[model samples]
Target: MATPEAPLREILKSVSFTQFPLRVIEPFFVADKIVKPRLYIYPSFAVHKETMANDEKRPMLPTFDVKSLYMLTALKFAKYDFDIAYTSEPDASPDGSLPFLLLRDGTALDFKAIMSKLQQNSTELGCATEEQPDYISDVDGDLEMPKNELPSEPVYRTMVENNLLPVIEYLTWTDPVGRECIGEGKYLGSYPQIIRNMLSWIAATDTAHKLKLGLPEYGADAMVLDGEVLYENAFRTLDSLLVLLHTVDDSRLFLAGAPSLLDALVFACVNVFLYAPVKSPVRTALLKSDSTYKPVLEYAVRIFDQYFASA
Candidate 1:
């Protein structure tokens, strides 16, 4: 039933149709042993419309879905139509609990492994990697592999891990306005108040944990005040990122030329930053950019226009 008491992973993992009135997209097999289409589950940004759509199943998806989606879209060589399940979080995935892919037998592949497997399959099947005019490095942040062979990777990793992710967590969990948005939009709409509050608390606690580990200087102590500190640090990093983004040329529209995994990751973060219904400090930071952060804004719009315009 996906009760609030149960871990999100349990709710997400149970594939039984009776669990919720959820749709179980059936797969079509080309042969007795060959599965054709696959099932993909990604996080959706729990929009207000989604919560209002139904009474029972109110699982919210993460903005992280966009990254995997970008990889799928950019891989022009592969020809597979995957059915999607927009699921809720915090992801109980084997890979840091992000989004995942379910196989015909219900085997789940976490995000990074999914990309690796796809790339390997494309090679084994003799499909050439997309020779797209731009030579963007294919550096997916979630993949537990060697860093992408791009000069921008270290900066990208720092921006994502240290700056962007913390700010996102702060907005989604710590900020008062962000808490309200998450409560009403992601949980409260479908869950009882107690359950939804717990979800928000857990999310905030996780945020603090992450802040403690990756960036102690961002202030993990005293959350109310810490939230502001985190925002300042996030923008401080973004300030530097803006410098890098400004210098980008046409051969690569995003970090490291063509659309690299960093672009997808950053794209997802920026979308949330720019679009969250709540006016968190981070959003305020962008709004205050007044024109100083023009490059960041343009980059986000450009990606959306190029990839998600029809999505």
Candidate 2:
């Protein structure tokens, strides 16, 4: 698979890791039944957790969105390895989105499709559900058996609507300070000033449009008064999720003990909330460790360490 001229890394502050932008790369296709996907993700940033980072060193940030986190984590659980490429223009994707999977069959799968593909191909690909790992048993292990099976769609709906979507929109679009950093590449850190500002506008407008559709409460007209409330809702939702995790005999650590799409969504939203590109009151609450959201902050760190693989 040959790549077009990738964006120069020398000017990119010498990224510790790099991914080929899809616009600049043509993926490989083969007749081989066994295939490894080429994963396209949002740009990688630096992970600096004042409360979460106990060590002196910081590691490169992984996939930027929750779905990407989920997809990568799900692949890890399925025991599949993939080639990764990062690009700021997820809009250029066939589906016009981020966190997509390009397979050897020349198939492009978005988040849900990626999950379906994993579960469908697990047997041929040799996943834990088919041919057990050295650990993570199928039927006998005490540890939660890691599989790619999905959770309830309603759970997905509730989380995204009340928890993830609003908060992401609030932070990325409605807030002015956050907008400045995004436009300036303080978060993505890969584009020219004009391109960065353009990407920021696209992301903000698209998310804001989604919020507008679910309007009245989230209407664009209400952005000034109600937008900040989205952060509060996100924090409370985190605490609620914590309660759900504690109360239910759900899967260990994650919603189902194994890495699934649901956890990916939750992790993406909460992770970005605590470590937004620009600091705000919501971030302050999580950072204080005295606030009610301290446990949720801790949970974010636990998942990051477990899945993101800190260097």
Candidate 3:
């Protein structure tokens, strides 16, 4: 009789990893089954503390990473079930990214693949159980947009994706104060001094390369990488979204009823800006001079209180 490991043996013959541990590679030779799907994500400071032994219980912590937060919100909206695993190592994922889903059958899924899978199985999935929290959207509830509104969804989504998301990334990764705040308060807090310093340097360099933000002047304190254009575009996008919020009737609870995927996306970005321990120019503008943007902020807050405020 042929075994599943036979093909794996042939495949591994040509693969070499001198530094990789044999214990890690040994799993590939076995056919153990994973019963529940698991979501691998960057560690959250609040979650880390909450799950610590003998620690007092606290309100469920919101996701610290933007991608993790939005993906989590979307999963909750879809009423999906999966276990959460906190990890700092992105190399464990097939695509070398955090927030990937490891399925029961050992298949890994990136964000787009996970969302596509949910859509394909929409009818079969999304049935909220008694154990599920009531704060989430009703699976049977209507979240469909009007026919005319449908066409505009993609446009607004693009505005948020292209403008708003980049600004968040710029602020969090490129801005000196923002990077320090998150690195100290969340991502690197648990690591020892030496390791933390090394990882922080690597993260900063990687982020600069990924976002194409030129480095600050050498030895210059309080200098920001050129983010003027990013901030300008972000404000324009915010103004446009705020105008749309004004046009909507007061009866609606969110930009869309029951909070569509776009709403979830917006909520994730805005909430981060509002609550991040960093000095966010966008957050300052929204709260100070641009009072017109308050409605959008209110919308994001409402979504948070409804779903993520508690576990």
Candidate 4:
């Protein structure tokens, strides 16, 4: 008798529990591929306004922002091609944060994720031009430094994020002068006055909570922030940064021979301290004659003039 034919369902079932595909597609997640990227940054103040002799108006100076400036610098340093769209709403991002990057394939990456993606150096990410070199040089051998050596780039980065960032927040949200300079109109300029005021109050409340200021205290109140402790920590952090800056060879623009992430961060912090319209004692300290922070002040100016001044 002819071999009994199996049921059609049985024939269609796999003979083996595991079967490998005959060919592998190059990229499994085609959606993750990046073409040109777009960066969404908070708008900066138009700090400088000038009228030309010919009755034409000159472009206003772009002010520095702690978050936006660093992200911008990092992308620029990577030689990445991108378009910048300024928005006041953080909720526009995938995770409700400002400074998120949008890849052409609709991928939204936060700051940490963006840095991680850049480090992957994937060709599909389109971070570099076809004709340009793909590798970014690490000027200092910090990556491979001995454990006991001066603090590495990672260490410095942590110090800035943890220590310096809070000070900036304190200044912007809790200081009277800073609040005035960063008026509600800066971000919510398009909204109606009533809505703007309401949103501003909500934002202030949220900031107060985040900054750990006690409830029932708001807007430049003594309970909002401890100026003594804040400035003390800032001074210590600045001193550490000054020491790090001194380690860089006089010839290089950044800690790394090339512009590294740390350079981006340092530039952002110092630039803001120097030129952001806020009345910060740190700015006074940096600019004072015979200031201990001369290198930092100079570094900020140099980076701005070289990279961001004309932008």
Candidate 5:
């Protein structure tokens, strides 16, 4: 029952590439040509970063679903090589649109079918979980508890007492079901040392990578951008993210310990600088043989070992 105009509008809104500037958009437009079969592509947080940098009027947090789609589109485009036109001048077409070609030999391709396949592939790649009998048992036991008396709060408080607020907060915020499990005075301390090991690895890798890129280091207590006090009044956002992850009762509820929106955000923010061709001296220092990140690398290895062992 859908008309051509309605479907076109829907596709445009769903892709949402226009939210970004020309620099980020150019890569995607070029990639789209190589993808073939004429599928609509979206942008990722990397593209969003450019928008945030170039347009002062852009929203702080654009829709996550839209961004996710855009990332997927970019990934697909990365698989191919194609020439594309890049321009800062706004499109002056009927709907102010950028033109793209569809790879069809006088036959309309099934966009819906292609999208479904891509979604399935993406989920499979992102959620490569191993079987954890013991962890599964523990999770089952927790789920069986009475609704009014889950043990999340007490455990959360324990984490707070042990100076584990960052991990706890990260878990709680990232886990969709955490809002229900979190209670006053409750801290997250039930997770094994392996989880802590993973946190250490993440923090260490992030720090080392940032230094290698000659970017400003992120302090545990504050956020400093280019040595200027951008967010003077706010607490360290990364710390908060880690706390939410640690405090949440169900670590696997949202994306279930796999790469979700949070992981994507963290990866893009921390690792994007590495994609550049030239390395910075600061980055060199962080990645040196005698670097401080040796402990973090070890921790990551330990966490991965635990994960595999428990599988």
Candidate 6:
């Protein structure tokens, strides 16, 4: 009997980096049984080196080696790779331009080892330096804002109770819209819609319209009434949701507990709201409501501190 010709090798090839989005890539590599090799082009290698030089104290901003960051972050919980399958032909100045080879053999690689390799590679390329950015000081300085100066608590609670929870539930539930809204894009629908609705409710100055829509009037508070109520509501709601999601130990409260898909889903939603450009009523409302939402903001900060802060 003739020996089979090695059952014809199957190669999985993709042009994108394995760590384009760390969160998304984490699970895919974890679960993949077959070859899922990715070819990452270090297009921002020079820019990344500059960013690292600017931020001296912190680990270099790994723009070119984002795959390494993903691996490091994942290694906080799992393991992943370092075996070099191949390296591209060296050009005249291949220092930052050459693409490094990576192979996935379905083995759990050491995170520290991979990080060390990346650092070593950077050093060999003469890119290592130490000059921390001024932005770091700015961030550190803002942390001292006193409690009394922060936003109020009641307004924060109202936001959570009224807006964030409903939006999260609507997104996660498998009802009419939920069924069709599968995959990563599902979370987008509810947040934008809710923000739009809240803006509409706030913009309607007519007492009758406010009453019909079940929106409360700001009474004689000219500042809040002017336009700040909407953003106050949004920030408060967002903070509450972050607190609830981050603190609650109950798996039932979210689609899954820590390390589940829900964590990513909710984190993305809350983060977008946090960073989104505020406009009109929302911007005005947030400015006035900031004092009232202090506790909630602190709670949000604390949660982030607990999870993301280095010990």
| Runs in model 5 lying further than 4 Å from the true structure | 1-70, 73-227, 231-235, 244-256, 277-311
lDDT of 1 by residue, 17-47 (tens): 6666566777786544314224344445645
Query: Which ten-residue region of model 3 has the weakest summed lDDT?
Result: 135-144
- TM-score, predicted candidate 5 vs. hidden true structure: 0.24
User: Per-residue lDDT of 192-211 in model 3, one digit per residue for the tens?
Assistant: 87887787778877767876
Candidate 6, 248-302: lDDT as tens digits:
5322322223232223223333422232221222223323444444333344334
Q: Which ten residues in a row have the lowest lDDT in candidate 1?
A: 133-142
Report the number of clashing residue pairs per model: 6, 4, 0, 1, 35, 15
Error of 4 at 114 (Å): 0.9
lDDT of 4 at 297: 75
Q: State the lDDT at 169 in candidate 6.
A: 29
Q: What is the C-alpha RMSD of each candidate to the true structure, in Å?
A: 15.3, 14.9, 12.2, 10.6, 22.7, 21.0
Runs with alpha carbons beyond 4 Å of true place in candidate 4:
1-35, 48-64, 119-151, 214-225
Tell me how far the alpha carbon of residue 213 in candidate 1 is from the true structure, in angstroms, after superposition: 11
Candidate-wise lDDT, in order: 0.55, 0.59, 0.66, 0.65, 0.30, 0.32
CA lDDT, candidate 2, residue 6: 62
Shift in Å, residue 102, candidate 5: 7.4
lDDT of 5 by residue, 188-238 (tens): 223455764464445444543543322444545322232122111112433
User: TM-score ranking from best to worst?
Assistant: 4, 3, 2, 1, 5, 6
Q: Pick by TM-score: which candidate is best? A: 4
Q: What residue pairs are clashing in model 1?
A: 43-61, 43-62, 44-61, 44-62, 93-97, 252-257
Predicted structure 6, TM vs. truth: 0.23
